[model samples]
Structures are given as structure tokens and as C-alpha cells.
Target: MTLRTSAVQESWGPTAVWSCAHAQGEHVKFFVLGSVGVSHGGPVLTGGPPQQQATLAVLVLRAGHVVPLHELTAAVWGESAPGSAVMILRTYVWRLRKLLEGGEPGKTGAQILESANDGYRLAVPRGSVDAVRAEELAAKATRAHAAGELEVCAEALAEAGSLWRGEPLAGVPGPFAESQRSRLAELRLHLLEERLGVDLLRGRHERAVPELTALIREEPLRERPYGLLMRALFAAGRQGDALAVFGRAREVLADELGLDPGPDLRLLHARILSGDPALLPAAASPAPGRGGGLPAPLPAAPSGSAPTSPAAHGAATAGGPARGGAPAGLDGFPAASAG
Candidate 1:
């Protein structure tokens, strides 16, 4: 390999030795998953007040994109921002810049954070933020699941789940952080469900049952987990238990929310009652015209959401919590009226 290096290329940090991340100079890795912090090739620096962390969280989320002051103010203080909110925000930015640089006055000039015309931008290196990495992995899982590459999908989702440290954006104070925290947490749940689905496909239904049951307990109203649990139980030869789960889901929805199970669950119940052979794992992902005419699989994931299905059992959602609506039927089968 001939050497054709330029002065500007050298200024962009050591690119050739990426295997060591910071093989030469100090590099930064911003994290938004669990707690908001940065790793400067050593111990993570998580020393900041809640509001400061909130500011960093917002910029970290929209990394590489400019965030205007007005938007930042709204995220940081919602509708109760004090008159000096802007000044305080600026101070937070300065403190964050110093903290990332180890507080050295003349640290090498590699400013990851920049202020442009009317907003600030965070330019952390790609794959440096766990949240962003999770999203990317989720996308990979989604694609694999869609293409019937169950093992690959499971691996990607598993890797994505491992990146989360704790409660996302933990201890960060701001509307933006709160919203993002909820979003990231839900993404993890969806990925978990997807992984479970892959396990079910691989004839590991016994293992999926307990996990799905626990997920249902935590999110009783989420119909997706309920459906997956039923599938696992039914696959493990607990047909009666599978139907009982449907009954429990119906009861919970009726008692707590004054709502019946969505069409997705209702249809799944009907199919299970009919003993649809397509529900069998061996028949999953069968050719479109074969498999006894089972319904089509889930649709592609929506933009800006988790790259996987919103719900494991239906076209309910692959990104976040399923909102109340006209949902499609269960995976691998068509819709049918509840029995």
C-alpha cells in the first residue's frame, strides 16, 4: 500500500489504527443508554448536575444534527424555563466541552461539540453512542427477521440488548431525556420480544414461556407479549394454557381499561381455537403460496423507530409501544373474528 497522506487527514485523528480506538491521541465515546456519560479512553466521566446532563443528553441524541436554542430550552425546562435559561444552557455546554476534554486548557483541537448559526451540534464519532448503536443493531435484526434469517436476527438483537447499562438516560433532568428514556426502554423490550420469537422459531418454546410471561406481568396491557406467550405455551403442548392466557388478557383489558383485546389478539385467539396448522414453527416462513395459506408476515418497520417489528406477534409495531388502533392480525396468519 502506497502512502498518500494529507495534512488535513492527519488532523482528523488516527484513522488507520481504529482497532485501538485511541491508538494515538485521546478519543471520546458519548453514551446515552442507561446513564449519560463519556469515556475518554479510561474511566467514564459522569460528573454533572441533572440539568447539565439533560443538556448533554439532548445533544447526544441528536448527535451530528444541529439543535436550536429554542428547542433546547423547551427540552431542558419544558414550559417553566427561567429567564436565564439560555445563559445557563450555554454554561452547561461549556462545562460539557471541558469535561470531555479532561479540563485541560490546551488539549488537542478535536472539538466534538460545535455551535453553528442558531443551534449547537454534537459530532461524536459513529458507533460511539450506545443508543445509536442499539438503533442500528435493531435495524439489522429487523432486516434479518424480515428475510427469514432468524439466527442472524437473534444475534443482532442480543448484541443490541447487551449495550444497555441501566435505565436509559438515567438521572438526566429534562423533558427530552424523559421522553428518550421511555423510548429507549421500550425499544429494548421490543428487541427482547423479537429475540424470543426467533427462539420460538428454533423450537425453544419452553425457554420463551417464562420470559414472555414476565413481560406480560410488567406490561399487562401490551397485547404482543400476551400473544407470544400464548404461542410458546401452545407450542410446548399446553393448548389449554394458551387459550387461558387469551382469557386473562381479555379480562385484564376489560377490567383495567374498559377495552377488549385488539383485533390482533382477538384474531389470534380465533386461529388458535381453530388449531391452525400454520401456527406451527415448522411452517413459519413457508413459501407465500404454501403453508396452508397462512397470512403474510409483518410489514417493514417504520422510519426513525427500532429497526425491528413493533410487536412480536403482529404488524402492531416494531419500534415502540403499540398505540390503540386497527392492528393487523397475528404473525404467520390472517385475521379472523374472535370466537
Candidate 2:
């Protein structure tokens, strides 16, 4: 996966992941978007043992940066590390160095992994790591969206989404792996919302419905998805269903969080109640005024989820995934306004 250098700079700024230059040649491709492993130049498609893989995962996540000895030990064995932990870590690094450098290195004899401050840095070429590449794509997508290039934005986010194979750091045990997994899951959600926003802007409301539905089911308390789903459903000629969506959102918010919908959501409810033509798909009608920008929220599926497809992005679930329940209604919603 190729990434734009500008995007890398945009995302990381002064503290980028590793390299800004897109270097080439015999570096092995590292993957942590799914399983923790490496490929290209090695006989073993995956890397070494569980602990070794965990060690490498720590390095891969911090690729281009030094990983201190203490952090490495915690990533591999947590606080219960044995006295021989240092020796084991060095041994793993030695084996990983060989594994990463096993392929041919004729003209471009790039260093795979290096040691600094007695710390480790996996110095593979830029864009060689799927996780890093995905972030670059996301950054690019953000730029494209800012430029009003809806199709380009959607494509870049979709490409980023496709890099995921499964649960991040799959089968790799340790605190680092577990934490990174959750972090990446959050990124996936942001990517999904980005794509959905583009789709909605491009007048793909019908297309956004299923995802919005799944998102609402997964995150009943979040108002953004509910708003998006309501818009999509309203534009699809299901105003009744759209109203029902607000009903569900109200129930869930009241029950789960013991709160009423915020100003944005209540105002949206008012607009829908007042028959805002701006809610129509953009392709069918022009939005004549301001104060109509939408928001995002998602949930309901068991994720380690992948992006919807090449055109769309992904869905991610979070804590206390909603069950089939809602609370009593609260009053004082915003009043409908005449535009």
C-alpha cells in the first residue's frame, strides 16, 4: 500500500512514525493491522513464537522509534517477567533481525531492525507496515474531504479500511497488543464515519442506511449515528421511520445515559418534524441554508470489523454494547422552527 508523504506529515507533524521519504528495496513488509507478522524475504510467512511475535508487535507499532528495554519486557510478559527476561528479549531480537533480513539485499541493502540506547527499532522502509500505511491513507482522505473531493476522499478511506485482515495483533498476547487493538478499533470507527459523511454528502443516503442501522444498534447512546440514520431514512421517503429513529434514540439515551438528546439532535428532530427539505438527498435537492451539518455515532456488531467495502469504510463496537432496552421519555426537546 502506497501512502502520500504529505499525508504522513499531516498526521504525525514534528513527530512522524519513522520516515517521511518513501524508501524502497529488500525490506520485509510488517503487518499489525490484523495479525502480528512479517513477510517478503523470509521462509516463514509469519514470524517466530508467541512471545517473539509479541516482542516484534511492540517494535512494529513503534516502527522507526526506539522501544526501551522495560517497555519491551512489559509487552512480552507483563509485570511477571522472569529474571531471564533480558536474555530472552535479546534472543528474540536476534532471531527477528535474521527473519527480517532473510530476503535478498543486492543494491538496496536496507537495515531491517537496529539497536539504540540498548533499545530496539524496526527500521523497515516507509509504507511497508500495513498499520502505518492505513493511517497515511486516512490522512490523505481527510485532505481530500477538505478539498471537497468526495469521491477521492471516499476511495482513500476505503483503501485504508481494506488493509485490515482481522483482529489487530491477533493471537499475540501482552498488554501492548491488547491496548493497541482498542486504539486501532477507535481509528476504524473514525474512518467509517468519514466515509459515511462523504457518502451522505454525495447523496448516497440509501446506501448509508444499513451502516447507520448497524451503528445505532451498536451505539444507542451516541447521537451522531442516530442523526445520520434519520437523515438517510428521511431522504429515502421513510419520514415515519426517521421519526421512529428519533424515538429509539430518545429511549436509548434516556435509559442508558439518563440524559436527553443534546441541542444538535433535538434541533434535528425539530427540523425533521417541520419537514426540512434540506434533509433530502443532495443529488435530489440543494441545501439552501446553513446549520444543517450532520454528526456520527455507531455500534451493535461484535467488531474486529472490517470496512464495508472498497467504496465504504468500517464499523467498530465499544464498551457496554447495547442490549434490547430503553428508558422512559424526557421532555424539553427543542421546538420546531420555521425556515
Candidate with best TM-score: 1
Report the lDDT tens digits of candidate 1 across residue range 137-232: 777876776686778878877877766777878888877776676667766776676677667666788999988888888878777778888888
Model 1 C-alpha lDDT versus the unseen true structure: 0.65
Best by lDDT: 1
The sequence of per-residue lDDT tens digits that candidate 2 reaches over residues 242-302 is: 9999888888888888877776777777888887765676555543455553322121222
Global lDDT of each model?
A: 0.65, 0.62
**In model 2, what lDDT does residue 121 have?**
75
